[model samples]
Target: LKAGNMVGPRVYSTGTILYGADGDFKAVINSLDDARSSLRRLKAVGAFSVKSYNQPRREQRQQIIEAARELQMEVVPEGGSNYFNNMTMILDGHTGIEHNPPVWPVYKDVKALWNATRVGYTPTLIVSYGTQFGENYWYDRTEVWKNDHLLSFTPPSVIDSRSRRRTTAEYGDYGHIDIAKSVKYIADGGTKINLGSHGQLQGLGAHWELWMLAQGGMTPMQALRCATMNGAAYLGMDKEIGSLETGKLADMVVLNENPLDDIRNSESIKYVMVNGRMYDTDSMNEIGNREKPRLRFWWQMTRGGDMINLPVNNTETHLFGVQEGD
Candidate 1:
């Protein structure tokens, strides 16, 4: 904010994780009063509430909740599989919970859950598991996502396909996050969902994260709100940058289609009005069109319009006869 050009969402950061010997940053509570004190201490420095990147068990987290009520500070507990022990972190008195959202049941009724706790959710799909989708069937859309880059980061050792009955080093088990189920679940729930594409892998993975959220369970309007309102609320900057209200930041997005009607229509963007300027999507697409033929020529030769059954070249495959001595 001081630089005058670092504009995105206003942020409230919890300085650092104060954890015990087990690296237990998410869980611990002697009492509610202690939780409140912890929140006040966090707020006194710079944060508006107490926040963490993981969740603890039910019994251990109670004290934090109790303390939060006493100090009138928000408590946000992030949830995940590897790190989060509790799924209902928001219900535990945290201002909100972070993403672990693969299930439709969880995303759809999330608003009700938030209202019930008076908190929010941060669906950071990109961070946790989006990139895990290696050469996934859906992402094979050459026009949308090319796989050349995948070959670079995706070594055989990086994959863990143990879930398959046969044990083989040939495949790594990562990718495809039950996205369809999750999308339907969250969209239908009509909750206050924010967009946070865990951003470590895909350069602009947030865009894809937001797109998936809309394609999975949110309308374009709903998904946009997740990127805007939901994120604003999660960051405690709702009054500042979440909406187009007077005195708020002059940021905007102009689209040709009603995303609310068809969330996928987001790809059909025409112009984007941001800060106070416009970006022409048509021009961007026009540039891409000129090079499309070059990119498609190889696929055209291999498949001849039959995309699904494209022949896999086996000339490179190796096979040898068993040794006679054996």
Candidate 2:
């Protein structure tokens, strides 16, 4: 996409997760040398950052952070719901913590410690730990499968299976709210709170995250900052991509409504601009900087009276992995 071969949002990924323990995608970081070598390999392959995922010992994780610093790469460690580990990562100079700490109603001690550093926090409230996910709230309240905008790009089979049968939870049972409250608390202390949807759904999940942030006591404008400027800063791209500044990349969403009036209005996207090229939000056809229509997805191409048979087991076939029966 960055090469302009595909039409979509600019994507930056670690390519493969770096694990410390025995699991799929392990990076073999049993020692400091291992950590340095592993990070060097990932950086060589175009990873601007590394995910130091669940390195058991503090020293092992620290080694990864140190290695990342040496390579000028950012280290985004997995929180794994461990408060102690998360605290240590923040103190040890990690770039950011990927998930919530899993503890709610954090006190002054937690906030004070986090505020002392610039380490970023991405709560990913949609899949908040130790509670019902925020994603289910929307599924229970909204007809997600009936959303014309979502259905335009996603396959009906995928959306129907997840949204049609909703998992209703008591209002209090939804843990993401409490988690979000903690997020707002720390954010008020000058901590950078980033918007992360945990890939719960395409495009819309981000709005869900932004709304949940507002539910935690943030003003609509503050919540919008988490979804935009804060995220760009966390990724070390603030100077080039965060706010609308002269000499910065022209990447922005043209919302139909002012989000400051209502956080939910953030999703009222009228147009999207990427690298100065403007596109119509509904059809994603280029309307500025060029004249072109969006290409058809594989599902749009008919195969003898039936839609193309999407790969059921191919993990890379779709944004979300395909299940066995799918």
Candidate 3:
């Protein structure tokens, strides 16, 4: 509060710990009791939540979730192979999934899993970057790319195609289903719809997510909540900035159109209020820059420019005297 600013967005840092099968978590913290202690340590350090990855066994995953619960920490699981595993994590107390490819993505039953999220917020940012979405992203026409500059580049994310590694339009286009499921889940009864942009250009992909959410079935307001209020609650800050309550920080955005009627209206932000101060879009455009990549665009060579030329699944896989790839 040194800024003497009467208000500010209440922030909570999510601490993610990468653990391998034979790492320190197993070597040093071998017992279930030790796991609880480790989580407590993370909480003591101001981490609102602790996330560990690279788990290879069901037993191990369950143990971690239990240990976190014993310590009252929200458990977040990253590995998903099918709808079974996805549902298991939700039932076993995982806050939400982090990838969309693991489900092999079929919206036919996504409403079931999404319903689980209604009891809580599940950030589908994984659905946007992983799965076939990224593949479709590469296929994005020049106009589509410009329309989605965030996915074109700047979104720091990954592809969870590791589960099956199938290729085709089916590989990269389940993004639509993810949005559809998210919408149905929220409309059915969700109170919080945590929006996860998967970290790139904060504005770019985040807006895409909202737009997709609306396209998939969410009303404008429902989609807006996914990015704003719901996201705040996922971070454990429901008392501060999720709504326009008194004593809450004046953190909000002023859009040209009412999002309750059109989710895409968010892209029309004219102003932002943070810490009780207004940031006009004109001034907002002048406060930020960009970052360099840590990896040499691995997808470029591994996948080739085939992204734009790839064929859609279930439609036509072959053309005049040539396989789509050939």
| Top lDDT hit | 2
- Per-residue CA lDDT of model 2 for 72-186, tens digit only, reads 9999988998889998998998988999998888999999999999999999999988787889988988898877777767777788899988899788888889999999999
Report every candidate's CA lDDT.
0.49, 0.85, 0.53
Best by TM-score: 2
For every model shown, the clashing-pair count is 16, 0, 4
TM-score of 3: 0.65
Candidate no. 1 TM-score: 0.57
Write the number of the candidate with greater TM-score, choosing between 1 and 2.
Answer: 2
**Model 3: per-residue Cα lDDT at residue 167:** 38
Measured with C-alpha atoms, the lDDT of residue 24 in candidate 3 is 48
Per-candidate TM vs. native? 0.57, 0.91, 0.65
Q: List residue ranges in candidate 3 displaced over 4 A.
A: 1-11, 21-30, 79-82, 104-130, 134-175, 182-192, 285-326
Q: Is candidate 1 or candidate 3 better by lDDT?
A: 3
Per-residue lDDT of model 3, residues 147-172, tens digit only: 33233222222222221233335433
- Cα RMSD of all models vs. native, in order, equals 11.7, 5.6, 11.4
